[model samples]
Target: MSGNTGYAEIATFFRRQIADGTLAPGDSMPTQKQVRQQFGASITTVNRAFQMLKAEGLTAARVGQGTTVAERPRVAATATARLRRISRTGRAYGPKERSVDHQARLLSCADPDVAAELDIELHDEVLVRSRVYMKGNVRTIASFSFINPRGWAAVPESLSPEPLERFWQEDYKERTGRTTVKLPERRGARLAYPYELAMLKVDAPPNAAVPVLVLLNTWHDEDGPLEHWQDVFAPGLWDSDEE
Candidate 1:
């Protein structure tokens, strides 16, 4: 087979083995040299096959550990699922949201994209609250709440540690004595950036072609935008109602 076809065939061979349970999670894959010799393929071909598997979240390579089968991919809870759950429970999705176990950090907003989203100036301070939703051991969703420093300071004492969504809503009411009328959300897919990959603990290499779902939300009233939110999810973690 041609070099290109060899790489694809190599990836397919391993993918089928993984699907059939022949190559269980944590099972070590053959070394690149071994694979190249076994298939009579070039080193480039074997590396390409490994890259493909890594992008699919099926395998990982680490220093001193070699490449091994990854844990089964977990499906993330969609926004629709969370909303339905909230409708039934009359609360946030579950204890995770209500608890203080998630990660939150305050940082300077150096990224122009985030500054524009929050209607703030570059280098301004922002409060970023993050939570990773896991299905068993596999991380499914990584959520971030970006708040303008001014708005965060104005939040009431009672709602100091509340969810970002709740904080925004309450802050708006406290300031204007009126409720927010609109929360617009936009969703799209993009390759995981380095910071996101590290945050999510994804096993893919930098600039890998794995697709991550990006959900952007902005809370607004007659005055203007209240806060901006960005949620990143592993592929298949979130399914939109429209899709």
Candidate 2:
């Protein structure tokens, strides 16, 4: 009661409890009302706490089932921890741990499939971003991003090293002067190719003959498509990373 009670703080407390196994996996947590009552906090404060836990994948809620503890999330080490789990588990993840290399070149857009997904109008302006990623001196990944000209019209000169979601959140607020930032609803991806392999400078092993990861990303506004982009990165490059 005397300690911090902010949304992030409450969330952090719940996360530690879950991580330490004090709150076992699959266990139901107090309802929003109950938490508020127990902590002498506002309902919004309690909800924020739950949202924090949800953000970290430490809790779940159902319309009729109320709220419950989520299964423990596996912790990993690297640039992006959640991404590491996503690479291994294929779950939705946020973009973090990525840094822009000032020396990288921006490429022209070419892939027809990428444009189709974005629903870009014929001859419409678009932004194509390409970069080759390296870990120290070793080339590790290549990324290509396609953005609708209008959607990214306010594209900044740079992006933060934070995860993509957080970056989008901050960027949208900056570009539109609005707090609401609509992100992509669906995403698709695939493995890399021989050309991709050469870009990464890593030899593809027998089973790893494929490039690495060929990713398709799309963003949408309330009205419609904002972006459809593709990225290629070395396989297992994200395996050991985390947020």
Residue-level lDDT of model 1, residues 75-121, one tens digit each, is 34454445444544444443222233365567888889888877778
Best by TM-score: 1
Superposition TM-score, candidate 1 onto the true structure: 0.56
Q: For every model shown, what is its TM-score relative to the native structure?
A: 0.56, 0.44
lDDT for position 48 in model 2? 74
Model 2: CA > 4 A from native = 1-109, 122-124, 134-139, 156-169, 177-191, 204-211, 236-242
Candidate 2 lowest-lDDT run of ten: 72-81
Best candidate, lDDT: 1
> What are the Cα lDDT values of the candidates?
0.67, 0.53
